[model samples]
Target: MSQLKYKRILLKLSGEALAGEGGYGIDPERVHELAQKIKRVRHLDVQVAVVIGAGNIWRGQIGMRHGMDRATADYMGMLATVINALALQDALEQIGCDTRVQTAIEMKAVAEPYIRRRAIRHLEKGRIVILAAGTGNPYFTTDTAAALRAMEIDAEVLIKATKVDAVYDLDPKVNPNARRYEHLTYLDALNMRVGVMDSTALSLCMDNDLPIVVVDLWGESSIERVVLGDDIGTLISS
Candidate 1:
């Protein structure tokens, strides 16, 4: 029998992951590699729901800083996420993983509209569901969406997959002396303004008692390690 710590999980991947080392737009080869990593976890019978960001394409805050309307910039960011979601969906399906793409903004021509019950059903039937377009509204980050969806779907935990391996007291890259938090309470993260996730998202996870595991997706078998109960990165809870 497969021993799994969290049978159901919500993974938050930044659009930058798809951008790869080049740092902009979708890179097909990198997307395919990510799909393979996801496939490894799916075969473990883990029910996975992913929320991807739009930083690689466009960032609402960046647009707003340059004088774009706040709502308009955010909406554009949401659309960018949909593009990443579709690309990811294509990659996963190409690898023979049964998948479904659900968008919050309701693009029926491309994907099913996000329906809570229907999404849960897809997981129950062994399909990996990729959630796109953020919260279907402006002014929300994909991090918030991940927390919200994880709670709505009763995900055992939320995995914040990032370029960095763990939550550190300081930037590990910039400061060689920075120390990593082997574990933390969500309250600790928020109190210290730790950027494990955006403040709003962290608060949501804390209030609901949903644990989050911060791991580097670039690490070999990192996703699988998290699902199989191996300690590979920072763990935050409460």
Candidate 2:
């Protein structure tokens, strides 16, 4: 009902967001809750696309530290994202929300390969498109994939769903007096190295002048507020 500030949005979700209390693996309840939230967003007549991380199931860095080959670990992490993606797709479809899971790495038996035009077309037809796999490459984070996919889909804004409500100069948990920024330029974020997002992903968004809103993923009405231009989170742009 409110005037939408961003008609098309790419939602970047960390896999841990679906991990529930255990903090590992996909929690069905959490996935269902997320599906409901996304369904609500779609009800607003906004085209929604999602890019999900695989931290819940696997972390390439952790694997590499444990002596796994870098590329192998990264590929495993990417496959983990597909597992998350399929779980989400099932939840959405069960609730009457149409969704398509597109993977950067081809898996024709399970999902469609990532195709830019086809993805955009799905969005136009009112289906939520979920992008899984981390760019089909090693040495890249899902954040980068989200940024790249956002640009490819011509999304008006990239909504980064995080555990925290906004970007703070320091960890709010560690320092009570840490400053919270309502807005920040891409350069400022890069300089600060806030760790909210990686440099490579940030650079891609910066190069394309893509606006990013970092908001609390579980906060009540958080995503909806941002979509309606409520200015409830740390907005990074320009």
Candidate 3:
């Protein structure tokens, strides 16, 4: 713990990450792998919080494009995040890691309601807290939720775990020659309009002076390395 740069961190993961090779739905093996990685981080005596998106189970945008009500679709997406959170909580528990699932929207049967003090207490007691339901509101992305929760919990850093190794000027998939940025200022990231995170999230982090790390989740011990201050990915800060 003395060697750790971040005593507490918020890991932001996409719903697609839990989809495995099929690119849809929860894959147990994938969830298990993610759990193992998280356990390793906890083993280092660091408090970990997670905010996962729901693109795989339900993409509200796709529904809205098909003429569905925006608020309804968003609410459905929020519920989908709860499903992912439960799956992740189960996996973490299976690995002998204590975890709690807190939802922004109340569903007492499945998870505890999101409460700032309770969540902080859980982390202090060495329990991983997985936050779900996207801020308990419509018209907000999970990215924004992660940002909000990170500040609410006074996290040392916000880790954006993604498939890509780092942030790039252009989509590396579309252009192989795109330049990757090892470090970026918050204003630079906001002006560039980085696709990995939304502007609202960026603005919130900027205002709060919270550092953001974009890293490849599958890289060998990548998440641990980030919290350990290894400079593993693109870091956005003031």
TM-score of each model, paired residue for residue? 0.98, 0.98, 0.98
Residue 220, model 1, lDDT: 90
Tens digits of lDDT, candidate 2, 66-126:
8999999999999999999999999999999999999999999999999999999999999
Encode model 1's per-residue lDDT on 1-238: one tens digit a residue.
Answer: 5599989999999999999676888999999999999999999999999999999999888888899999999899999999999999999999999999999998899999999999999999999999999999888899999999999999999999999999999999999999988799988899878875999999999999999999999999999999999988989986
Q: How does candidate 1 fare on TM-score?
A: 0.98
Question: Number of the top candidate by lDDT?
Answer: 3
Identify the runs in model 3 with alpha carbons over 4 angstroms from their true place.
none
- CA lDDT of every candidate: 0.93, 0.94, 0.96
Candidate 3 residue pairs that clash: none
Tell me how many clashing residue pairs each candidate has: 0, 0, 0
Q: How would the candidate models be sorted by lDDT, starting from the highest?
A: 3, 2, 1
What is the alpha-carbon lDDT for the whole of candidate 3? 0.96
Question: What's the true lDDT of residue 102 in model 3?
Answer: 98
Error of 1 at 166 (Å): 0.6
lDDT of 3 by residue, 19-89 (tens): 97767999999999999999999999999999999988999989999999999999999999999999999
